[model samples]
Target: MATFATSEQLLVIIDPAARQTDGESVRIAKDVLSAGAATKVCLPDGPEEFARALGRRGSRRPVVIGDDRALVRAVTVLHRARELAGCALSVVPVGDTALAESLGVPRGAVAAARAVLDGSERRLDLLVDDSDGVVLGGLGIPPEPVRAAAPEPVTAAAGRTWYRSLVRTLAPGRPRLPAVPSPGPSRLRVEVDGAAVVDLGQPVEAVSVAPGTGGLARVEVRPLSVGAEATPVRACGQTVTVIGADFRYRADAAVSGPVRRRTWRVAEGAWGLTLPTGS
Candidate 1:
């Protein structure tokens, strides 16, 4: 069950974004897939329909055809249904394929379709959050907020001539300030497996949690530093927790929420993905 049979029946889920991004690639993928497997093509118009389509897939293998978001959505749907471990998922990268490439799926439509027809399923680790959110790749805490630009008064003596005035009128510019330590570092309490790795007393630059080898999550906390660079506090554990002021995080390709706290635990080999043989 770890690899698809050469002619396995496939439920091909064509994401909306894929059709809008490139119809030619979609057609090519469909043609290639239909030529090989007994494929049932599904063109889901929205997220809800997509989930419904996947949920109703029965025993057929789900082959997502879209970008990273589409793949993530599929994973999330199956994970929530508590059937991800038994489901071997495949993807035909149609738009943004960076995540697929990292996961060992080919970049183009034809290559990915071919691999789907002839590839092995590899069980991969995933992170499940307290909110039942699924993270296929990784997650990070405290994405830097965009800073507001302050207007600097133009001095008469040091004033730029007509070019500067014209530029100011055309596009108000922010000062190119040198990169310096943030005036205020985020005060987050980071804990791995219930042991406080970084207490609330210490301010941190960022915190990262990702699936590591052997069913453990690799957690790293970067302390706010002045002067010399400080080494990140690192640990590997089954669970990682971050608590502090409301903050946002980048999980995989999307930004989550301004939550006061969140915890993620690793599910070892929680899901299977179809990758190129020997990948």
Candidate 2:
């Protein structure tokens, strides 16, 4: 791992969409860091520029100024560059609440910036998809309806309020689709560490497996049913596989693939990230 000096220079990548929301606010963050005399800021206009900026991140730490998606983009770029293991990431969230709150980043851009200025870095586990892309949070099956809804530019607070209202409204109703009959499982085969765990043709709603510390894999299988509770599938192993009908899956807040099957492996302590203190 690369060691950074206490007075190391820093690069700031501000998502273009976020710049439109409040460019001045982003400027404020930049000015704050400049005044601190402990960092330097680089604002990128798009993903291409973002990648270029990160390619040159060097020993200077990176601070992302945008939403969860922005954070994901930064991590993806660093991971692709094979620098994630050594780089510490910071985020000033300007978008959706689900991901940021779950990751323990503050909502206000200024507060998040402050945290970045004073925060300690720690190693965190990241989920890697079949494509070898890293996801900073948990993955989920059956993409949530809200995810597909078109996003409108709204303040962070307003967006959170709207999302909470929508969740409350949808929580009480049965899913729009008919529930798969009991024991009416779909054909899915699962394996862990090259061992056949579940190989059957039955009704299966979703299957999730989490790689734990020390090469352990936690596996959980849920049957397709109306109002089935979503729970963690715990496992500790290096590898996991799932085969089933084509379905959409979400990694972090980004959606990917409608593949017939997919596989994931744990790359332990793959990235350094900053989370809220005491979290």
Best candidate, TM-score? 1
Alpha carbon lDDT of each predicted model: 0.84, 0.66
In the range 111-177, model 2's lDDT, one tens digit per residue, is 7777677666767666676787776666655544453334444357747546544543455432232
Per residue, candidate 1 scores C-alpha lDDT tens digits across 1-279 of: 366786668999999877765666788999999999898999999899999999999979999999888999999999999999779999999766667788789988899999999989999999999999988778777654434344445666445334344554465332332322333578999889999999999888888888988999998999989899999999999998889888778787677778999999999999999988887
Q: Which 10-residue window in model 2 sums to the lowest lDDT? A: 173-182
Could you tally the backbone clashes for each prediction? 0, 17
Residue 215 lDDT (model 1): 94
Top of the candidates by lDDT: 1
In candidate 1 the C-alpha lDDT for residue 216 amounts to: 97
